[model samples]
Target: MKVQAGELLQKINYPSDLKQLKEEDLKQLSQELRQYIIDIVSVNGGHFGASLGVVELTVALHYVLNTPYDQLVWDVGHQAYGHKILTGRRDVFDTNRLFGGISGFPKRSESEYDTFGVGHSSTSISAALGMAVASHYKGETDRQHVAVIGDGSMTAGLAFEALNHAGIENSNLLVILNDNNMAIDPNVGALKEYLTDISTSKHYNRFRDDIAKVLAKISEIGPDAYKLAQKFEKSIKGTLLKRSNFFEALKFRYFGPIDGHDVEHLARVLKDLRDIPGPKLLHCITVKGKGYSLAEKDQTKWHAPGLFDKITGEIKKTVYEKPQPPKYQDVFGHTIIELAEVNPKIMGITPAMPSGSSLNMMMKAMPNRAFDVGIAEQHAVTFSAGLATQGMLPFCNIYSSFMQRAYDQVIHDVAIQNLNVVFCLDRAGIAGADGATHHGAYDLAYMRCIPNMTVSAPMNEEELRNLMYTAQQDNMGPFVIRYPRGNGVMVDWQRPMKAIPVGKGRKVCDGEDVAILSIGTIGNEVVKALNELNAEGYSPAHYDMRFVKPIDEDLLHEVFGKFKKVITVEDGCIQGGMGSAVLEFMADNNYRAQVVRLGIPDTVVEHGEQPELWAECGYNAKSIAQQVRLIGLTRSMQTIAS
Candidate 1:
């Protein structure tokens, strides 16, 4: 008990090392573990609040479970920073989310302790259930499988589907619902309300158990009376304990609404549950940002405070000499409010990212118009479709990676119906720190293939405003506007909103040499490359192909006929993105030109700064210039031969 957490944790490279310590020592371990995460995240700056909240739970799970052998799956890996530190990643913890560093999320390739790779929420229950079933089939009946899911994640349909199937299978799996009542933003919906009722109503559970025992005696006394008594008991309990009432009906042996922060209690409860068979769920109540006072005060901002002072809790911000452009999300946030004020039918909807997508601004301005639909992506998509059916134009703001979860809904409900739902895909490119699991690299490929979808990406903040303004007008079908993470390039972005003609692109810098066609914010790099190429006397014509779906065919024909060498760049995948779009167009038109496609390759990009990742992908300004130089020389050779 007197052992220091810092000292104990230093020796802990694995769960077996953690298990060597006495049970009383876990309290100190949890403290040190919380401080450790705060210390690292203060300067390093990845996910802060979630990891701090789950310190005790992480310590208890690793100490109790035979991890690496017995499976442990974290729902969203935002809470697994501490798990990484304890599991042989202590030295490299400082390198978290840095260029060439380990992934921010739990990756199976990174560690044996991380049983499954997870980034998007609500997947742990399904993955853990699958593992438990696999264990059962393999005759490893006693192998313990656990899935630690957040309360916010439980709102998703996938969680319920897995819970339903797990009940039928009767697998020995433990689902630790880390009921923090939050995800990125504060949780929404009836599930949060129900969980709160369950967490608070301890006496109701005891009373229900006592009453159930008393009611069972009616069957022993008289069979005919017992039938009526069962119906009455079920009906009354359904009305009385509606919260704890649902899980028991799902065939899960429910326990807790217990203090998740209590390390000893958690360890003991987990040990007890380890011996119990069939599908089990332990509801552990916890605070989102528990340890740090400032973090606990403002959970959303504290969730990922960039380079904050751990002691004073003051965030470090760059003292810019000039006015800096606002984040693309902030632009969307303010723009949505402005657009909604003019149009009565305009509404905003985000899955669980009201704050992240800056839709919280709309929520604050028009609470009825903007909605946070929880971590249910599929539900959010269908809900938007429902709104669209009522002549309401819904701006469905979902992160590009998260949009994949609701692809089927987007196709079946919205796209097929030709509903005028606007998809504002925030973080449509490489989302830094969150890694490959979160990179919005495939949205263009997927969205473009859908029949009634118009895909577009803005080069700067001005274009974003204009396109958003244009899409709100009477349109044929679903429209997608994708922009990158971080700040936009334009300092004065809020210009007068004007409608941009669909499927048309404007040439930025004209040249007699190679033609460069770029899409989205990635075109910013092309502009830089063109400027640099001009200084070097290499004139590569620059064109921002605004619309990826109904591509600027007029511009493409002009470029191919005039210049034989073309270079296409995009932030999305090279497979079926803007580059592929250009290739298909050239093939269809029978244009003989040397086309070089530059974009994200068919490889998972690791956690890194955007610049470094962009450079590595060969889409940065410097890399683009190099490619342009090679293209200029290749075309010169072709001209000489002619």
Candidate 2:
């Protein structure tokens, strides 16, 4: 179905077209742009509330700036849907986040208007500062560089690092702090409190309004009053506001706490700021899900409510006939609570991903025990280590991709010290629609390499529970349990938990011709493959290697002694992953085997559904079955040759 854009939006094919509109028309343009985003996303299914929240600001930035020449970078580019639409991508907007289509986040290759490619949080300030510095070096003095970053992203140390450096550069950089108080969930930390204080200050607001009137009158009076107005403004900022303002200490000229939804005023302010020199910050206070009533009420739930009814505000869901298995995240959420209930030592920690990682359940059930450390992945890891030093078993739940940010902390604070910290890496494989940056593709390889790290992944919810139970036990140093996003194989998942021995694996079935070894939830795919192969009278042995590190040597020995042809499968990268681990074990023990490794290959996998990605990566059930058949065919041909 072709969703028609509004009359104003239809005319705005590019920022150039947007520039042709009257100043008053921008409000209508914002409304149309917001509706267009709603129309496309309601059917197409991508991030929802974030793009909705930044509609007015998106319009204002493009309206004031000479985009493409004047660089603009979006922090955590999920919120750039409006930016994308305005920057000549409105026609193909329906293809957002689909496989082989446009990306969910901004990409440098995709458009010249996208000054910097971004997927992760808190990168905008640094990127925009770099652009600004380059422009300064090249003598492009008129060029403007802007970074639109969320308050949630502001909590990260990287943002502060950029701000600290940007202050000294004397570059034309504008850091627009989009203070919607959200990053998937509500913003937390001292920064959140500080921003709240500034935005809600009655004294500051009154003084700002009074000063604005005086400045307006002074500007009309003449050049001398304008000079006095500038000095007066600086004096007021230094005397009354600077003591309380955090950004001022960092040497940034903080300019706002203004209504971001006001399109005309925002445009005017942005136009004014463009002429001002050095590092400046405009703190525009906006709503996370502005214009949408239901989204405004429950921002988190509507953050990415896939395929919703824009009219009725009803989020769509896949209707299954029978009882379906719970998502791996929900299983973790419930299972952690179960473990924490009995074990007093167990505590939970996540960096700005309470809901995403499902630690919100633990946060609700055991409020004091679970902590949301804002957008500081490094802090979350080290903080978990700190808790571990005091004998508190901390399950530091983080997305596998996001864990890359805390690699140093994981090794230095936890692994090197041999702290008993249980690292539950959620979204532990091809992370679907959010694309490559979000994919949990490297944790298997990364975690296994760390000294004293017990790296493991579960095949199903029951195994996950068992793994969690096992990790919490005494003397288990720096345990790492990773699991994929979405549903596990088992329907009845909440079975009583029991500890399985570490470095152990189990034989799912015994066979004669060939052997198939797998690790983690990818083993479930191997099961499906076996079923298909069996129907066709092909018998292949299967072993589920639960732990990647301290791999089951006994199981490997059993397989090598029986079969010459073997296949290793994992949901992670083949390089340094479970398949590589198995091959290492085989070579170490001096066992010769014809091994065919199947997993994520050495390439960038784009956004798609889980099943589509698995097939594309050649490790799905169908792919596995085909591999087994091909191997069986080759063996028969070799036997005939002999």
In terms of TM-score, the best-performing candidate is 2
Clashing pairs in 2: none
- Report residue 35 deviation for candidate 1 (angstroms): 0.9
When summed lDDT is taken over every stretch of 10 residues in candidate 1, the lowest stretch is 207-216
Q: How badly does each model clash, as a count of residue pairs?
A: 0, 0
Misplaced by over 4 Å in model 1 are 1-5, 205-244, 636-642
Q: Write the per-residue lDDT of candidate 1 for residues 1-642, one digit (tens) a residue.
A: 122337767788878889999999999989888887887888888899999999999999999988888899999898998889889987788888888888888899988888999999999999999999999999998899999999999999999999999987767799999998889899988989888887777655554444444453554666577657656656655666744466768877666667889999889778777755688888888988899999888889988889988888889999999999999999999998889899899999999999899999999999999999999889989999999999999999999999999999999999999999999999999888788988999999999999989999999999999899989998647999999899988898988899999889989878888899999999988988888889988888899999999999999999999988899999989999999999999999999998889999999888788888899898999999999888877767977999
RMSD of 1: 4.3
Q: What is model 2's C-alpha RMSD?
A: 2.0
TM-scores of the candidates in the order shown: 0.94, 0.97
Q: lDDT per model, in order?
A: 0.88, 0.91
Q: Whole-model lDDT, candidate 2?
A: 0.91
lDDT of residue 36 for candidate 1? 78
Q: Compared to the true structure, candidate 1 yields what TM-score?
A: 0.94
